[model samples]
Structure formats: structure tokens, C-alpha cells
Target: MTITINRLLLRADTADGPYGTDIVFEKGLFILRVENTHGKSTCINSIAYALGMEMALGQVTSKPPFPPSLLKNIQNENGTEIPVISSYVMLEVSNDRGQTCTLKREILGADAESIITVYESDIESISNNGRNLFIHLEGDTSRELGFYYWLAEFISWDLPLVPNNSGRESPLYPVLLFPLFFVEQKKGWSSIQATTPFHLQIIQARKRAFEFLMDMDINETVNSKAKNKKLIDDVQEKWKQIYTQLESVAIRLDGKAQGVKDAPAATFDPFKLDILIEHQGNWQSLTSALIGLRADLTQHVKASQPQVAEQKNESLLSKIRELNNIVLQEDSKYEFLLNEISFVKNQITATEVRIENLVDDKRKYEDLKKVKSFSILDDLPVLNNECPTCGREYSDHNVEIECSDDLMTLEESLEFIKSQITTFKSVLNSYKMQLDIKKIELSKLEKQIDKHGADISRLKTELYSERNVLDEESLREKIRLENQITEYEKGLVAVGDFRSTFDILHNQYKHLISLRRNFPEHGFSQKDINKLDGLKTKVVKYLSEFGFSSFDPQLLEISQDTYLPTREGFDLGFDTSASDGIRIIWSYLISLFSLREIFKTNHPGILIFDEPRQQEANKFSFTGLLKGASDAAKSGQIIFATSEEEDVLKGALEGFKYTLHSYSPSEGKILRKLNKGA
Candidate 1:
């Protein structure tokens, strides 16, 4: 059964379509639609609402994203109150069973029980043997549903067909057509991604075509001579640069010590240093044992009557003791220096590299999508006897040519730059690696240096006290400093940890910059910012080609930070600064295209358009779309609601026939809805 909207009611001032309407049908097709000004679109919208076609009926209302302080304040000029609520749409539907259904819907204030509610009119059985079925909107009506129930009704033969329902009514026929064909509009032009590898079928063709072009160009100039000159000049220049840089480095190398911030004292352990003093005492004791052994040897020599020489034995003993002392002192000094140097060097290097990487990241982000031009690129031919622009007869006018591209040009430049930076970074990284080693070295130095301060102070105190034996005070100070050094060495493990509290952020950064995707074959491409600048130049070039003025070219700019051009910018839209009528035409086209896309993907063959000729200015642009839709509707059904100028509709819908219907509370102007099928 076919169902359609017939009429609607609304206050004169509202843009929300109609508040109430009728359900009228004839034969099997819905007939007699009233425009929104006449309150029809709103009415049918209600039916669309009942059928779950729209997210909501009436306008979509949202709170302002910002406070009023951010907005312009306009006071009421006449102190007149605007209606708080928007108007609504009422629809009339009837099927083959002669069952007529009226649906009414509207947006309610937030305080209202429901954002939207449906109201169904009582079933008015139009024929015998029809069962009452006005229970579609709900099992029962309440205030929550608002005034919808009272405003709508079903009047058809099927209303009384069921047993124990109301009464029985006659049968009604089914509906035939409601075919929909929407018009599409064009917008801005955009280039598609085309640099993708040529598909297998077209790769060789592209290669051959470019090679031929290059060879033809080569014929115009002597490339071989230029290559020879470049090679000669490059080697000569490289050697000259190397010799000068080496000389410059020799002259500039500064051996003067760096300005030292006093390496803070490395507090040390007297207890450990004193172990050396204990070893000396052991040496002294050994010397006494040697003395005793020598006495015994002297007595034995005396008894052996001048067989042994005492002076020779004493000299050998002294030499052995001196060698032992030399080895131990050198080894102790080497151990101390290693710990001191490692820490400071690492800290300085890491800080510097971090600064450089951030500097490199100032220019950033865009979403990459597959380019749409891949198909066209693949289909382009390699060898052609005729012109590429037109399929034409072969002529002897053009010459054949072959060429080769310098593959090394791009690849070599990238490789060279990457290698230089990578090598420089490696040197810098070594400096960083030495940092921890330096930290440990520095701590050892501090411990060594701390004892000197104590000794100096002890000497000063002894001198102040007028003590004759300053050595005693020096010994006591050394012990105190040594105890402190032992404490510091114990804490070395914790102090040597160079890691800052940033492991988590490091993990995330690793993901962003270095995580390699599995699909490396798909590859990645980076366009130079200079390339975008080049594109801008080309945009100006094109605009000039189109006769745009030099001072104010009518070309669009695209930027990552701010994008101003949209799909509808080039060929359509109110935003395009087009004529009002043109704007409406564009808007209508877009709407039709969108509707078609949606319905084509999922069939809900219905349309509910309002203000097709909006704000009076859209009349001219909207005229064509309306006419097209009307023409398509001859084989189907479409319900358009508008408060448009009547002359415009008459002009656009000139050939189509529509039942004229009107609505009003004023007596003698009433056109109540009727169910023709019943």
C-alpha cells in the first residue's frame, strides 16, 4: 500500500514547518500535499519521524559552546516575545488496506517529559469489515506525547477489519510508485596521490616514456661534457677543502686548560689511605728483622775470618725496598684518576643532543591516505605513434627518442646527507658514553682532594697554637678526612646512576619516532616544505592562466595549520561567494548527492526537504533542482515543504500536477485531511 503526506498546520511566523495535517489518499497513491507555508513538509516529516527516517524532527538545537560574554548581545527592539518552541510536521499515510494513518511530531523544551513524542488520531473506519488500528503511536496516549494524538487520525476501510477490535470495514488497494532520483553538485578540485609505484602493467611503460623524453632533451645539450667537468671540479675542490681544514685545525687547536669550576671536594677515606701507612710500618718491622739477621751474619762472618763484606749486603737490601715502594704508589694514582673523569662529560653531551632533535621537529603532521590517481597513472601508455592528447593518425612530424634518468641524483644526495649526520652523531654519542665513567672518576678525585683541605687547615691550626709539632695535627686531620671518603665510596652505586625520572616519556617517544610499521613495502614519503611553497607558486601560475589579476589572484591556499578550501569551494556553495541562487543550487545538489549516497547504500526511498527556496535569495539557484526532482517524481513520490515565493514554485514545477490544499483556523478556510482510499 502506498502512503503519503497531504497537509499541515503551523503558526505564520515559524520556520519549523507545520504543526498538524491530514492523511489524504486516492486510488492507491497519496495525493494533495500542502507546502510548509501551507503546513505540509512538517506534516510529512512527522510521518518520517514515525517511520524512523530522521534522527529528530524540527531543528537540531545545541547549547552554545562558549559563554555569552564571548557573543554579541542584541536587545529586543519591540519588546515582543518570540515563541520558545519551533513548529512541527504532521503526516498522513495510507496503505492498500484503506488504512489511513496520521503522524504528528515536534521538539519539546528540555523540561518536557520527552524530547519528542508521537500522537495518533482515532481510527475513523471508512469502509465496512475494517478493524480499528489507531494504536500505532502507542497503546495509549498521555500528556508525555503532547498534543499529537488529538491533532492526527486514521480514516480508512482497514480501521475496522479485525475481530473484537472496533468493527469490520472494506479492503483498500496497494500503492504503485515512489521512485527517487537525486541531483548531484560539484565542488572544489583536488589532485590525488599519484606517486605510488606504477602498477605492474604500467611500470615499464612509464619508465620508457620518461627515458625517451630525457634522451630527446639530452640531444638539445652536451651532458657528457658537463659530467666530465663536474667530476674534475668536485675532486679538485674536495682536496683543496681538506688541505685548508687540516691547516686550520692545527692552528686553532687550544691546549690551554678549560676554566675549571672547582671540582667540589671528593670527600675521601683516611681509613683506606692509612692502610698504605700500615704497609710502611710492616716494611719498617721487616727492616728490623733484616738488621737482626745481618748482625747474626756479621757474627758468622767474624767467626769465618773476614770471608763476608757487610757493606755489599746492606746496599742490596736498600735497593729491593725502593723498588717495592715505586710500583705501589704509581698503581694507586692510576686508580684514583679513572673514577674522577667519567661523570661530567656524559651530562653535558646528552643535554646538547636533546636540544638539537627538538629543533629538528618544529615542522610536523598530516594523515596519509592512498592517492586516487594510481589508476590513471597505471593506464598511461609507454610508446605511442600518435599524440597522447588525442587518438590520431601516425605522422612523420615527431621524432623517436630514448633516454636514461640519473638514478643516483636523488638517492645519492639522501645517502650522503644521512651518512654525514650519522657519523657526526656517533662522535657526539661517544662523549655521552664516557659520562658515567667520568662521574666515578670525579668522585675519586674529590676523595683525594678532600684530605688536602684537612691537612692545610690542620697546619694552620698548629701554627696558630704555636705548636712545635705540626705533624701530629696533620696526622689527626688526615684520619678524619679518610673516614669521610669511606662513607662517600659506599654511596657510589646510587650517585653513578645517570638516569633521570623520564623512562616513561622515552618509551612513548620511541613509539612515535622509531617504531617501524610491518608494511615497509608500502613505503613512506615526505614532501619538502619548499615543495608546498612550489605548489603555491603553481597555484598562482594557474590563476594567471585563468586571467586572474597579479595583485589579487583568485587562487586558494592549502596549509596544514589552517585549511580554507573544501570540496564544494570550486564549483558550488554559499561559501564560494556565488550568487544567492547559485548557492541554493549548490546546496541542493550537495544534499541530493548525499541523500543518493545514503539511500543507494541503504534503501529508504523517501525525501523531506524544507525551504528549498530559502531566505528568498536562493530562489534562482534552487529552481533547477526542484524542477529536476519534480520531473523524477512523476514515476514515484516526493514531499517538498517550503514557504517559498509561490511564483518560484509555479515556475519550477510548471508541468507537474499537485492537489492544491490550504490550512487555517479562520472559518470557511478549513481543509481537513481525508482518507481517499477508505
Candidate 2:
């Protein structure tokens, strides 16, 4: 990507006459040489103003950066000040692909500083064709009708989105990138990338700008990591929500999820976790309990009607005997189930104790590993299996015990303990399931025995009573049981549906973990590393040429973490003198500007400096800077404004090929009244 300024036209339509200046830039090096206070800085500022980028020079506001000559009043040839009625600045720029566009902005009208007029053609044809775009407004950096968006497209730059202070994303505004190549006179020389607008709330604004300029892939890498992390968090949150819902429903059904985790894990298996309910001091699986309730409801519905005709005493006695026999059989089954449930519960308790012991042992070995890592107590007798005083094999002093060579190392022991814990947990779950089944069977048998006893009582009552009537109590009991069964069935279905989604959530969790693992370890690709290395090399070379003296130029390095120049892992600004700091800034900015020659960069191939020589840099250093700029200009353009004397400046130029636009003392000023055609 390349952006080159072809011309800057500043026009002021005043009450007396037109007062402005027009300056055209060539392909290579262009120097604006003039006396002090001759509008050199004004010309430089006009370029930014016309491009709708004055915010780079300072804070963003409605006030323009131009002098009063174009804003309030202007002086005529007779040295008389004239009031200015209106003014505007225009700049024509072209890209590497030879596409040109002229930008115009008014300074003193209704559509003042916030509006920009873009002509698809060069400055000469701007009057014939133009389209109005807006700036300094919301969405100006991204909207199609915004000037920055249009400018970015024209420059062939696909701006990347950077994170802002609000924890959201915003485009890397063009103003941020301009400071890298266009340095104003006042604050641009204060530090490296000094003109960057931090108030935009862009996090690490300088580093992000550097990455975009170098075309690094770190942004995509970071975005991918953030995206996957958000996905994982979402999956976990949803899993927790589903678990909470399942728990609520389970509680409503007089049951709870057993051995189930609230958080989703790749190792989670829904089938292994049991849902159990407790009734009459016995625990049973929810499914089994529902089945028993449904059976009871069926039996109640079958027995809801009363007999219409009287039965013989012999028939009643026969029915009562049959119910008594069923009661006896069910009571025997209930006792057997009770014994089985008791044994299983004991086993479950023992397995749980074993698992806890194994877990504690694992934790101890892990702590030992940490101690060994720190080299503390590394040669302890117990840790090395030797006696402390004699350096002999240690013994536990157990007479009947025999020592073996198959003992495990600390790491191996930790692994063994982990496996033991896992095995015991599985055993505990199995025992609990067995206990649940036996208790459920016991509950069912007890229900059967009670039902048979009730039947026998009812038969005896009928045999003694004379009057026959509808059993309204039996009907009400049947209806109540049926409604309970319906509710239990609905809860069972809901829990079942929840369990089904576990597989999907677990799969999503695993996929997100895989994506996280696949991201680059350092968040930078090989290409990004190569570009950074190249930049470091150029920066050191430029520093040497510019006579950097505060430290050894060879000690300078571009930091990968902050993307700033450093000295032996420390910041260069700490020990650098004022002049050396200026030199460092020049080297850093020039190296970035020149990178387009070697790599595919977003550098616009144009560099503008209000004053390249600052901080009272020596003549040789200034000359070296000029030469460096000249060499860089071979492929692009370098425009700088200077106030050096003619002879000294001429000496500095030496053999360089450059365009000299000079305003001598006799010329008085850069902006003057235009000649009349008549």
C-alpha cells in the first residue's frame, strides 16, 4: 500500500482579496525551506487539514490548526490586514496503483471542519467532480459515507479492527497510522509515535498501529483466541444452566441427580450419573420409583368401583385367604431386598473412604514434586529411601514385612494413586446403583404387601356390612394417585431430555479445547517474526548513520512484546539524551517508512516531517538524516520543512537529488494576494 501527496492548495476568499498559497510535491524528495514564521508549518498543517487528519497533530476539536491568515484575517501586499470571510484547504493524493483523489475541507463555513469533499480526479479537476463525505462524526471510521473509510479504500488498505477500552472492537483509524510517517513540528518530536491519539480508547494503540503497518497476522491470532475462549465460556455457562434446570425438576419429583457435575467436562458421561429419590428412609432410582407409582395408580383405578350385588360368605372368605397369601409372599421379598440394600450401602461407604484416601495420597505426592522442583529437601532420607545417618536403605521396623525392588517413584506413585482414586470412584458409583436398585425393589414389595392387606380388610368389611354403596373414598384415592403419576412422568421426561443434551455440550467443550490448542504459542506467525527482525535491522542501521551517541547502536533492539525499540531488554528512552532521543525517533520512523520496499506493508510510501532535525542535532547527524531521507525517497516521497540558512542547507544537500521550494526573506511570507486577471 502506498499513498503519495501530489499537491496542497490552500485558498482563502477574504473581504479584500484572495490570500492563500499553493505548493506542489514531486515524486522524490521535496524540502520546504523558508525563514522563521513564514507559513512553512502552516503549509504542512494544511495537508493534514485537507485530508481530515488534523486530529493526529493534536486533540480533536472544531478549531482548525491553521494560523489566523486563513481563519480571521490576512495581510495584503501593502501590509494591511484584511478580514477573511471564507477559506478552505485542498490536497491531492495518489496510491501505488496510480489512482488519484483530491480531498477538500472548508475552514470557515456552515460545512466547516467536519466535512470533506472528495474528487475522484486530481486537484485540477476537483471543481468539476466531487462527492461530499463526513469526518469527526460517529461511524466516520467505518461508515461508507465517512472520509476515512473512503481514504482507506483509495489507499488499498484493509484496516484491521483493534480492541478498545470498552472491551469492544473498533477500526484502526487512519489518524493513528499517519503519525508514523507524518510528524508535526510541536509534539511529534517529543517521542516515538508521539502524535498517536490515545483518547480514542484504543488499547495499546501504538503496538496495534505498528502491527497493522507491518501487516502482521498477530491480530487474527489474538481474535481467534478470544473468540474460542468466549465460545468455551458460553458452553460452560449453558451447561450450568441446564444442570440447574435438571436439579429443579428432580427436586420437584422428590429426587436429585447423583454423581453429576454442575460443569460440563469432556469426560462427563450422562448414563453413569444416577437420579435417585428417598422414600421411608430408603433410596431408590427415580425411574424405578415412577414405575412403581404408575403401577399403584393402575391397581387403584381397577379397584375404584364398589360391588353392586351381595357376595356369598364362602366367596368372601376365599378372596380374603388369597390376599393373605399375597401379603405373605410380598413380605418375604421385601425382607430380602432390605438385606441386599444394606450390604450395597456398606460397600459404597467403604469405596468412598478408599477414594478419599487415594486422593489425599495423590495430593501429598504432588506436593513432593513441587518441593523437589524447588530443590528443597531433595536429598532427604525419606525422599531417597535411605537412612539419614548411615546412608543405608531405610526400613519401617516392621518385623514381618519384606521389602521389594518394585517400589514406585514419586511420579509413578502419584499416577498410581490417581488411577486408584478413579477406580474407587467407579466402584462407589456401581455400589450406589446397586443400593438404588435393591431399595427400589424393596419399596415395590412393601407397596404390594400393603395393598394385599388392604384388600383383605376390605373383603372382611364387605362380609360383615349389610348395606352396599359406591366407594367414593376409593374413587378419590384413584384420582389423586393418577394425577401424581402424571406429574412424575412429566418430570422424568424433562430430566431425560436434559441428560440427552450432555453429549452435545461435551462435544462442544472438546472442540473448543482443540481450537485453543491449535493457536500459535506466541501468537505470531513466522512471517510476523521475519518482519520484526527486518525492522530491527533497519532501525539499528539508521541509528548508526544518524550518529546516535547515548549508547551503542548495536545494543538497540525492537521489542516483540511492545513493538518499541529497546536497549538490552530495557527502554531506550530511559538513558537517551534529548538529541539521541530525536535520532532514535527518526531512525524508528524512517525504518518503518522504508519497510514497504522490502515487505508488503500498509505504509503509504510518503513521509512528511515538519522538521527532521530537532534537539540541536549536530551538522553531521543532520546531514546523515537528509541522506537517509534522500535514499528512502528513491522509491517514494519525503517532504520535510526546515528553517536552516541557505548556505548551511546547501552544504547539507551536497549531492542529493531533491526539489527545493524556498521562501526567502524578501518574499516576506508564503501566503500572498493573487494577481488580478484585468
Count of steric clashes across candidates, in order: 53, 1
Give the alpha carbon lDDT tens digit for every residue of 185-262 in model 1: 111111111121222122122222221211222211222323333444443454344334322321221101111111
**Against the true structure, what is every candidate's RMSD?**
23.7, 9.2
List the pairs of residues colliding in candidate 2. 3-604
Summarize candidate 2's per-residue lDDT along 545-617 as a digit string, tens digits.
9999898888878888998899888888898999999999889888988888888888888889897788899
At residue 232, give the lDDT of candidate 1: 41
Residue runs of model 2 more than 4 Å from their true location after superposition = 35-38, 60-63, 67-69, 73-83, 136-144, 161-170, 198-203, 240-244, 251-263, 272-276, 282-285, 295-480, 676-678
For each candidate, give its TM-score against the true structure: 0.33, 0.72
TM-score, model 2 to reference:
0.72
lDDT (Cα, 0-100) at 524 in candidate 2 = 86
**Which lDDT value does model 2 have at 516?**
96
| Residue 580 local lDDT, model 2 | 94
